[model samples]
Target: MAAAVVLAGLALRFQVPGAYRSPQPWRPEHVMGLVYPAVGAVVLRRRPRLVVAWLVWAIGLLAALQVVLQPLSRWAVAEGATGAAYLRWAAFWIYLLEFLPLITLLPLLYPGGRPPSRRWRPLLWLVCALIAVNVVFAALLPMRYTVGPLRVDNPVGVALVGELAAWRRPMEWLTVAAALGCLASLAVRFRSGGPVERRQIGWLGYVLVAVLLLGCLDMVVATPFALWIVPISLAVAGVPVAIAVAILRYRLYDIDLIVNRTLVYGALAAFTGALYFGLIGAVNLAVSGYGALAGLAGALVVGLTFQPLRLRLQRAVDRLFKVERDPYRLADRLSRTVQQARDPAAALTSALASTRQALGVGGAAVEIGDRDGGVRVHGDGDTADLPQEIPLRWHGATVGRLLLPPGRHDARLAGLLARHLADVAHAVRLTADLQASRERILSTREEERRRLRRDLHDGLGPTLAALALSLDAARLRLSTDPASVSESLASLRERMIATIGDIRELVYGLRPPALDNLGLEGALRALADDLPEPRVDVVVEDADVAGELPAAAEVAAYRIVQEALSNARRHADARQITVRLRRETHGLTLVVADDGVGLPMTADGRVPRAGVGLGSMRERAAELGGSCTIGPRPGGGTEVVARLPLSSARGAPAT
Candidate 1:
């Protein structure tokens, strides 16, 4: 089905004049007469009811061709084989007039939606029937042309041309009125139509008006020797070509763009040609035929002055066509505004406002990721309906989209603005990423400093104090009596053990060796061994989380559990602590629960912030792109549950 439609559409565009040998006495120069109705038949087959009225009109036209023109051509040829026969047959010509109705009905059959109502069908049929019968009767009894005997010889020829010429004025007025009616009907339908329908119908109107103007020019201004006839040929081919694009490619203004470009280049070519001819002509007139040397010098001068000439020509063309200026300057201004912006809000505001201004749109907006992991629109105060959202990309990743509402009046400008706005979004996102990265680095530095301070005060300070006490005891014993050295050695041994314990604590505080040597489960077990009052019971289940965790992830989880236990010991005042490490289908999970004195609360009854340890634990979880929650256990103490997402970490290395 798709292939057939494609072929039919191609056949319409693929015109080859004199390709078919017609059974009729003579054929028109163009093969469009055979192709147009064949394509129309395809449309009718697809949408019978929608084009029933059009088909009625088309059948009436074919009927007129057979009934009226065929008989006249037969009679004309029967008279004699002379050039007069050509004029006689041409007088009853109805081929060109049939195209107006065909073009009007073409789009109707392949409309953007369902067909028009049956209410308009009968009236359309009535018009076609009247025109059909009128042409037939007019052909049967031709009227007189010139006043008396001036019409002498070819009476039938003069009569047909004269009568047709006489009716031209009224017919033109009728054509204009009918076209206006059709346009008004389409406009009314368009207001209530969808976006596709509106665009389609709008292009149809352009074609319709083009058709009307074409018919008028052919009937009114086209003298046999005048050059106005050129436009008549262009109108016939151009209008259908426009409609074909609208139907197949769904591009309506592409034809207009081509036409405009053609006009531009055509004007430039004509100017160059005129300059070449005029330069040569003037040189000949001045010197009674100048030498080739003079012509060569003039050509060289024109070549050297080409840039300036081109610029002047461009300005003239812009003035004549009223072309829109490029918005590169506006884009540059927007970039500067974004660079100088003080905050995310300000940058977004400037970007959207500049986009709206440059493109002449109702409004525009920018969206970025928020702290809660969802997109939030900025600059427009509220989210309006978006016509199109063109994503901004940097390094093949989409940062944000340039959002504008649908049916923006200036589509070409709107597309251009979309690309510019995307560039601005990319720049803004890059800035945001850099600022965020800097803050993270600074915060991490401050955290490392705090950890070092805590280790020095709690571990190294006590170990040094114990070592000094042992040395001082040994020195005192040696000074008093050499025989009591054994007692002094025993006292030094005890102090030395205490110092070693302090050093070990310091080493563990810096980095737990069990995490690297044994894995997450072993390190967690060793951590549980340290708690005194709580009597920690460690449960390691399923064992999938042991070696699978990245060193950093393992370290983070171990620190989180250690902090929870420490919090339970100090604040929750818990007696028994249970640490559970388990692996699920998605990721690793850790739960540390304790039976303790519960937690302190505010007047509103939510948990109060008593220490920075809990905050630190939550921050650690967040750095790993995971979540943390601390709440009172149902019966007594507190429960800290941490869930780390493994989407990126699914079988990934530690780094």
Candidate 2:
């Protein structure tokens, strides 16, 4: 296997127009070419025992295929010591037979199959002993190249060749049985939720199937040609093709789009090139009578032909590579099916059936993660013998896994199917999360309204009632006693004013009426009017902030200004506060500045500004999908600037 790979690497690197020799034999490119598969094969290296076993088997098989055939062909042509050559090559084949037992044991070595009884090793040893005896018998055989009779002319055990040849006919049937067993085993394993095992087993199965076909083709073709030539050459071709299919993961999953484009565009290019070149040649031949004129005509023809060909090829290439809904047509169909499904069961059924068809897996199922650290079988149609649980994951977190039974073809098909299912699971989980969030938001909103109504009834109602009683008492006393009535009236008047202030504050707390009445400009003006200290300057320009915004947005903008003003009055100690409201192209903007001692910068490279109000203001602005910033002004003050969307501002009531 290594030699074949090395030769192939050399062939690619040499790019030698000729078949045999160029600097190709010793090129560094060949060495680098071997590096990729070797590095990739590191995954197998984790189980060094298994890897070494397979490596030994591959080596033995390759030796039988190449060493005996290549040298025998050369010796046949040389026609010297031909008898000795045949005998030596036959010995090499005998030594290679020892590798066959390994193939039978390979699947058993996997963590599958029932635990073997104690007699398993003895049976294995007995098989090995028989293989060794057969090898020794074949190695002792003698041969002669010149064909006078079917039996060779050499002395030592040449008759054994005839005996072995007869034996191979029945053994061929046994080999066929073994091959079928391998396919069945892989299919059963795949359906058993063993994707990784299936992938490796599947590759071997594909190669064996191809080998069987080639063998059959050789037997049919060998009557006319030579029997050895078909098996040696065609069988060799099968290995690399199968390996390429496995290594490149060709047509495994979503990469079918790339494969389709490559095929279509490549064929188009070849066809166009052939047509253009052929036409050019034919025109040149026909116009030769005109001599130099013919040359010009041919050139014109070439030029005219190229534009159409290039344009067609370019269009084909463009279409091939274009991003469209049908990139992986089968996968896309499955995605749409899942999207349109009414419930998880339907989605899983569609997904499993479609994925199994798309990937040719034996069985498939969706495993969902439970709240506890365990997984549950969500939906699937896997066979009874398959594993109950499959490892599922999203990102780095294990979500769940799909268990697929053994497939009809390769085990690798299961792995390919599982990967796509994992993505689908992640997307479904995200959709569920979004739905939960929306429900929570609705529930919280109702609860908040209930709490606000309760506060109004339980807190402000008594205060207002007491103030009304106090005024009534003052009215009753006024006509009875002049001095007493005057004292009662003064007390009543003070209490009534205070109560009114409290009621107004409470109403504003629930929701600002200014915002509801006249939009953001009116609301900011109202806020400025309500502030008790530090004469505030209000500037309103181009404040055509109109249109309805979300309810949440209106409250956010109003609250931001309220909080910023409160902070300025409490901390800035500024003599004057300037407030501005205006409309920009995208949204409404607000700027508040106070000419007070600016926010202090802390010693730890942080701003020491008290954010008692800023955090709530920022949160409010963010809730509206807007932004706010509070920082020191250039002219010895603090500036609070905010931008809220116009769509949100419109929903605020006019102040």
Candidate 3:
């Protein structure tokens, strides 16, 4: 049908008498008529059920049909064929009758291809009735119509042209009312539709607005050349194109961005141009003799003010379009809050609030861990049921998810939020770990203090008291009985030696005396030698045996080895043990393997619960920014491995 319309239009232009001989080379109406129908035809093929597309196609084809028939009708009448002239006239009037529905019903049924509501169905019928009435009046009326340069009598009139002509004014008023009603329905749809629908409506609205503005301009200016007609015709042509774009949803979201930037940049350019010209004129007036300097000063002023003007225009445009959410501003505000926040949880809460405000979304939340029972929410309120979840990641691991209110998913906004919140999430995780470490350190310290107190009270204090009494007795007996003094001296000497042994044992428990003299490697060698039951082998790599390690690292490594050996002897039922230490670029690595029964296992085949010894060893290494691992060796024995950094700056103080 679209091809036929184009062919017929071309045939009429070439063959019809004096019709194709217009002075103007290009006709806007001709182009619009051909283009709108072709566009509609393409769209209709894709969406066969779209009533609006059919109407649009019909409107365009009928317009071109009228243009073609008018000249043919004139040629027929000039050749003295009244019947042929009346037939063409009837066809023209029928095509003209279609205009009412095209304008009134098209907008009402657009996008959805249906009426706005059931109540509007009656109005649609009324519009059809009006078009039928107009067609009937045009057919039966005894009126004579002008076809181009000739006037021909209505050959098939029923002698009712006077009454029909009288009714024309009322029908025109009704047509106007119907068109306004259709526009109102469109406005209602635009108001109620979601973001996607709104954008589709916006495309249509933009063309209508341009046409309306051009109409107003035409009325006010009254140009001799009809300059407003060009833009008005172009806007009419653009209507179908815009509709096709909207319905197809091709780059629909970009329409808003395009409109926003166009308005901003266009306004900025206009304002700057005006300012430049006004400055140049003022400078010219002030320095009439110095035209060059005035021009230079005006250029300088424009160059200096360009950026400020652009920013102001951008803000104005954003406000106008209600696209005021600035991602950078939101990110900056959240960054500052996160930096100043005393706790990670607090920082996350602030970030969620900022995200909600920036995106104009509903309740936002930061949910840590699983979505089920393990979930930890920080937000305005509970967000377990929120549908949208963007993962909050630290390093490469997903530590939590950010839940947002129900709406269209915006990948750009989600990506931006994720990037900004990554640092905060990482900081929160670190803060929690630091707090846990502190608690463990404090608990370990308290336990050590309790052990020291018990040893001092039970062993050293009692022995010291006994020795003092013995010394006093010896001193008193020295003058009274020389024989008693010798016996007192021997008892006091034994008591004193026992108290020194108890004190030495307590000090050894705190930190090995061997470590102070033998260094880490020597200390481990002595420990292996001291073990009486298990055959122990100590291997210190050539690089590490002579290298000096940090004090904290040395202590942590020694304690770890001591704990691992104790665990092996008490739990593994081992007969032999091997300890190895190697030096790397960053730190020292230690490994202890026992040739005994592997780690204790529960009925489920999992490693048994870790005891205090294992926990203390891990904590000691962690305090020095190191790691400890105890697992079954590949060869059926328990292996303990630890890596401690050599630099003091790399470790945090355990106390």
Candidate 4:
């Protein structure tokens, strides 16, 4: 019924004679108003109980009815109809329906199609009361209101009109308050809402800005350009279009980018316009003409500077929303927060709280470990429901996950949080690793001691006792059996030489013989020279530095090189190998490269496994307060690089 009534009114608007019509008969209140009811119908089909769709339908139909009444009343008068006055009066009250619902009720139930919560019920009724008060006051005001192109007296005017006037100012303020309350409701939802909710609100926000700008522009250009409000009011259709787009969920949640650009360009336009007119006015004031030339110059200047100014403003506004652009600042701030925290547990908690505040997300939480084994910490906000989860990893293992609101920028937050968490936990892990390494070293020393004791007691002791017995026999039989004594003495001499070799083997087990015989550089050169299959070169830029290196560092560097060379020789099928040693400021860097089949990698280009040889190299370096990394070399081979720092070198005998 509303659609037919509105359709006839619009058709009659164009068909009515020019004499009875205003200059234009088209509806200026909402150009392309058919969209509103259509959108309302769409929303109603999806959500029958939603008040927003109902409000949209009411607003659209009534606006159309307002257009129809003017011509109907005028026609009724021409026809000498008995209720012509009544028709004109109806037009007066109906115009109230146009803006009241839109600014108040519709926005209150917008996007979500329901009140945010029961707490807002009072505000809803207050707005309703305000709307009712304005209507009653207007009806009883005892004045002619716009009915068609002329004023029409109220048909049901009451004597309380004077009394109502006394309260009108206060009521006006109350009505304005009600309208703002509805807008506040929308804003609150946006701040506390989830990703889907934000995207919905963004649509309304987009259309609101466009309509507002167009509305203001229409007023400015109305008289000067002779452009009717009808033309600019077409932006009103954007409301329904935005509604449909939002509710339907057609595209990505990229509203932030769009809205940011709009703000930048809008401000640019406003500034440029103000400058243009200011320049024109100044020129006209100075010289009694040539304002056109000043306007042209201003236009040219604005045009030339527009792009540069836009870029600057864009960056400025972008910073306001995207705080993740500066990683150093974020990292430094989190680093301080974690450092200030008293304990290991407190570090994660502090980081969570700080991140929540910084991101301005509705809610955030940090989960350490998996669901079954780990603990979860939540920050202050709407963390009741966090839809996005980003995992935090340390040393290629997932340590935990960060739970945040569903948003496009969540990925960036994930990466930042993961890195920060890893850094915070590293000290604890490193301490644990050091303690374990110390225990292993103690166990290895004890095992070495046991082996040495066994070698002497079981093997060397019996041989020496037998040699003593043989010597005694030789003494006793010197005169009686001199020939037999010579043979026995020769056997004793062989036994003594064998004992010396056994002692040397035990000493070598404690410290390599080559390390004692030759210097650290010489040991590395000997290892390379022994590898006959692959041609090897040992390089040390400063030979003196190698000799002067701390004993423990030298040992670590030599062992790392030895293990790397062995691995390359046995596993890496290579034609050439290079052992390069550099004396760094506080440490030694050893790099062993083999021109062989590069390191075997997994399908994803990662090292498949850590071999014992590789692990040994890393342990040796770590014992000397340094690091070792093995990876595929630049051109076509595997390289094992280790650093051995002199400051924390494990205690070893100096050469």
Candidate 5:
């Protein structure tokens, strides 16, 4: 059909006289007729199901027919051809057919090329009936219609041509009604459409509105023929191109951004121009001979106001378009929520929700682990099948994965979301670590309480009870026999002395008394003196080390040294032991080395099960945000080294 239309048009143009066929300014309607169907051909090749493509192609062919037949009929009448009357009638009917679809069906079928609803189908039929009536009356009217410079009579003449002409007014009104109905249908579709569909209609609407405005201007003003024709023509031609672009969704996501920037910048330019002119006029009125100065001042004002005005205009445009899913705005919102959120899980959920809303995807999620450990997911719905997954990293480790539904891929938005999630994940992991550490500290404290209770109840209580009985017996014996009373009194005194030593030992086990009285250095020195067996040495690198250390650091250092010495005495059987305390800029360091057998290790290179003491030492340091390491010394003995950060210790209470 397209080929036939094009060939017919070319043939008719060639057949006209050379004088009448001089080069003419391009006509928008003819250009649209030529190009629209070609675009439709491309669209149809890819999407054969689209009804819009077929309708567009048909419209293009109809336009071509009108352009070809109307001129040829006029040439025939002008030359007084034998069949000129029949030719003119045929052209008249064709002209009616050409415009009927455009005014009645094109808008109704545009975008998706279907009625807005089942109810609208009846409206379609009504438009068709109106077009038919109008065509019939136009054919039967016995009027000599002028075709260009030639007059031709309608072949099928009616006796009541005046009545038919009077009836034509109602038909014309109905055609206008149908055209309005088509526009209404378009509006309905736009209101009910999705993002992609709305964009398609929006592009077409923009072009048509621009053309309409230009036509209105042409009517109102004495515009030069050249001035209105070119722009008006281009705007009309743009309609089909815009439709094709929208249907294909080529750069669809960018359309909103493009339209937003254009509206903002366009309005800004117009406002700035008006302001410049107003300022120039004011300045001329105020100060006559300073036109150049006024122009400079106007330019300065525009430059100063440009950014603020653009921002305001952009926000206004966004509201007009009802755009709610701006990535930058979403990022800002998530950032603020994360900062204020007390719970990491809650923060993650909020962030994912924002992501889903911003991207307009099916769902979104954050999965923290693999299948074996059982995935920990946050966000709405199941995201196992989501197409895109961005890895969230914290401290150079992949903490989790962010999942998003399939659609137009936005790499920039994805990166921003991933970075935001990574921060939240890091905070969540730290919170988990802190909770675990607190639990361990509570457990250790409970164990120490049980141990203390056992010592007081089983050991000290029984001994004290026995001593009281002995004293009672001694008191009874003193009244009867003098020798028995002396022996009993001496034994009771010995028992009482031993009880005092046991109580002191129990108190020392709970906390080093030397640490309370003499600080870390003195406590380590006293510990060395108490160790029995091989010789022991205590070295203090700085005199002010103990004084500068926080109480938690002081206790942690003392306990670590004490535990190392006990371990060496019980397990290592070292010949000699060395306890060293060094003060650094950030913290205090304690190293205890023994010339004894090193730690027992299993085949898998793990410490023996009896190495709970080593773990206890590590826990102590960790509680104060420090570290403890136990390994073999370079000289074939065990070395236990601990570093305690003074700053961390100052923040944390001594355990």
Candidate 6:
């Protein structure tokens, strides 16, 4: 059906005899005609009952149908078909359908095709508000760009351009806001979703983003003979194809290399074009009356410089996009360009050049397992022997030792440089504690899975079987014993309700029901309400703070607060407690304090001892690149303070 519609649009453009068929403004950008609907169909099949799936497919169908509207409208006007005026008007307002769903709902409700959490509803409403504004403003104006001779004026006595000059700026801003809202929705989803779902978003996102990434050069600098048109067309068409691939996960692979090469070549084309033009301009200024000679010389110069320029650009783009992606490139050059000191090899003779540059150090080196290797020295400085060895690490995994000259080193800066040295010792440390950690994580996960399986098999399975038997028995007695049938069905209903309770328990075990039902803020308040004697008060400093938290961070925060409240109620003998959540640019700060006898200090008389509950809280924070600190409050009582970095909470390491 989609193919036929698209083909009809194409055929009508060529064959339809319209009186004023100047040209079809519909370019290959509108080629979403066939692919869009087909992809939507696949998604609907995967999620048969999802309402958003139907919306997505319907949007696709509308867009596909829109392909032929222009040619169809022109043909209708020429043939004096009824409703031709309306069809012409549709060409103008049809943009509402195409833009609204994509901006408002689809980002928040793709892949699984369900509505996002309730917190996201407001952002969607904002997008919808913008859409409504656009519709009202646009619909009031005329759309008379008919391919045929017929003049279609605005029904409201307005011009074709939709000129409410006062509202125009506001409308443009509304579009910008709508676009921002869509992006925010996508960002939130990406941050909160599981790894597989994140991958799915990535598949669709980078493809859409590539159109912008690749076109940035052309947007800023013109390409030769308007060559930007070809790539832009292909990119637009690929949007729907990428949607299909993302939904189906067909031939899914890492998109980084693809993005890198495509962007490099795309930008190189623009640069080459600019260079050619510049050369021609120079020749034209230097000589007159020999336009052909100047043109030939310019082409020759561009041809000669193109390959070398592309080679340099390829490496530059690789440096820009891919760091430590390929093992062959020198790690120094892969990270940053060498300054005007001397040769890059001489200026940054080692892999730790970036770290050296960042720290303003005299020299740095990596020593692993006493293995003797060739060292790349930078200058005549013989300070290598003056350095001391510190435990080397990469992202918290110890590899070897970092060698730094004796100085008052910054703790944070030193830790970073130590981590960067790990690639050198990665081979030897592959089977270290990392393996043990992985095994422990896997074993615990498997044990939990087994428990869930056992519960389902032993409990829910039997009840369901019993319900089926009862239904069969009731069916058999329906004609012979009508009174008994009522009694049996009543009993069956009670058993089914019990089964639902059991299922709810299992679901609750998977995730906190309160978090799912009432969001983070409400869940915290519910925890506070659960505590009666303590008079717990929950205060969330920022209104939008909870909404922006990722799912894992949300769970961690709730669990930490719950534990703190429990400890204060049971252990501290506190009569008052406060849970405060504050947002920062980098992360969130959660403080749970209670007015009671202060926590027992360790032998150091400063830090509180970490028991099971404290350890669990600390571990959760650690996993998110955050910290949990338990100590005595400034005034009195105990304070359990935690910092959760938003970048790590979002599952991205802070760079």
Every model's TM-score: 0.40, 0.42, 0.52, 0.51, 0.54, 0.43
lDDT of 4 by residue, 261-367 (tens): 77888889988888888878888888877877988988997888788988788778868766444567778878898889887667766777667645655467766
**Predicted candidate 1 versus true structure: per-residue lDDT over 297-316, tens digit per residue:** 66776777566767666666
Model 2, runs deviating above 4 Å: 1-43, 47-168, 180-508, 512-523, 529-537, 542-556, 564-655
Question: How does candidate 5 score on lDDT?
Answer: 0.76
Candidates 1 and 3 compared: the better one by lDDT is 3
Could you give me the TM-score of model 5 versus the true structure? 0.54
Candidate numbers, best TM-score first, in rank order: 5, 3, 4, 6, 2, 1
lDDT of 6 by residue, 242-277 (tens): 666666655333444456667778888888888888
Weakest lDDT window of 10 consecutive positions for candidate 6? 370-379
CA lDDT of each prediction against the hidden true structure: 0.58, 0.56, 0.74, 0.72, 0.76, 0.68
Candidate with the greatest lDDT versus the true structure? 5
Model 6 misplaced regions, further than 4 Å:
11-16, 20-22, 25-30, 47-56, 107-120, 136-147, 153-169, 184-206, 209-233, 289-308, 323-655
Superposition error at 362 for model 3 (Å): 19
Top candidate by TM-score: 5
Winner by lDDT between candidate 6 and candidate 3: 3
| Candidate 2 local lDDT, 491-600, one digit each (tens) | 77787777778778767877888778987677777778888898888787763554555666568767777787888898889899988877776676778898999888
| lDDT (tens digit, per residue) of candidate 3 on 557-633 | 88898888888888888988999998876578889999888977767665665667887887787787777778889
For model 3, give the 10-residue run with minimal summed lDDT.
19-28
